[model samples]
Target: MSASARVIRSAEFQAERAWGALPVAELDGVTVRLHWTDSPYIWHVNDGEEVFVVLDGQVCMKVREQGVEQVHWLQPGDIFHAREGCEHVAHPQGVARVLVVEREGSV
Candidate 1:
């Protein structure tokens, strides 16, 4: 890695097929990761807050709230924030890239 400050080319980040997560950087109690997915992830709750940003393609975010399930369709540039204890899952329509910011080691 270069020692100088730089920019991250979100579109060019490393990703193969299905779902993949590549760590970009880590901040105090936070981790930034680039994710690529073509399928839905299992329902889960984060240990802490999560900021999910769609960089490319589309995603359907399934969130459970007050005993009800809500679906949110996300496009490029859309951002979805999930607070801790918010059960949710992400379903990518096809090949999609997302930037996620959350507590380190959270799931």
Candidate 2:
């Protein structure tokens, strides 16, 4: 596999001036992405495990467990891990940047 070094200023990252993502890297069918958003994402369950890291700003993570919804506050440097089949959604307090790692094509 070929690899090169690069630098990403996460704080200054944006995609089309909208809430979206930028592909970072991939390894063994897993994908790493940098996402910027000021809105909430749809609630869905991942087909595989997911690792979400708050890179900048704040977010409120919501998970549905046993039909009960739970909410957790996330700040910069906080990490949230979602196992396969875990239903969850993320709501950004403002414009927030996040690093997400998961199986490619998973949603």
Candidate 3:
């Protein structure tokens, strides 16, 4: 068995880029990434489920459900789960640090 640990400074990471993702870990079939964004991402569907966690700032998660678009506001510590085939896009309110967990290369 192998285990690893890391200390991430979210603020530092966010300050480095306006919008970007940093790979943190990969185990089994899941990959963990740290994202810093101040813009909206294009709508897309994940090949598998995705766990989006807000570590800092806010996010407006837009999802297409039942042929309608729904907006979910997320704050720090909030989480939004997107099941497979769920079309969604993320809009950051400002400088937001997000932790994303999903199947490797699902996006």
**Top-TM-score candidate index:** 2
Ranked candidates (lDDT, high to low): 2, 1, 3
Query: What is the C-alpha lDDT profile of model 1 across 1-107, one tens digit per residue?
Result: 67867677867765676668888889998999899887888999999999999999999999998889999999999999999899999999988899999999987
Instruction: Give TM per candidate.
Output: 0.89, 0.93, 0.89
Q: In model 2, which residue pairs have backbone atoms overlapping below 3 Å?
A: none
The runs of at least 3 residues in candidate 2 whose Cα sits more than 4 Å from the true structure, single-residue gaps closed, are: 1-3, 17-19
State the weakest 10-residue window (summed lDDT) of model 1.
10-19
Count of backbone clashes, every candidate in sequence: 0, 0, 0
Runs of candidate 1 exceeding 4 Å displacement: none
TM-score of 3: 0.89
**Residue ranges of candidate 3 with Cα displaced over 4 Å:** 1-4, 15-18
lDDT of each: 0.90, 0.92, 0.90
Candidate 2 lDDT over 1-107, as tens digits, reads 23577788998898775358889999999999999998889999999999999999899999999999999999999999999999999999988999999999987
Question: Who wins the lDDT comparison?
Answer: 2
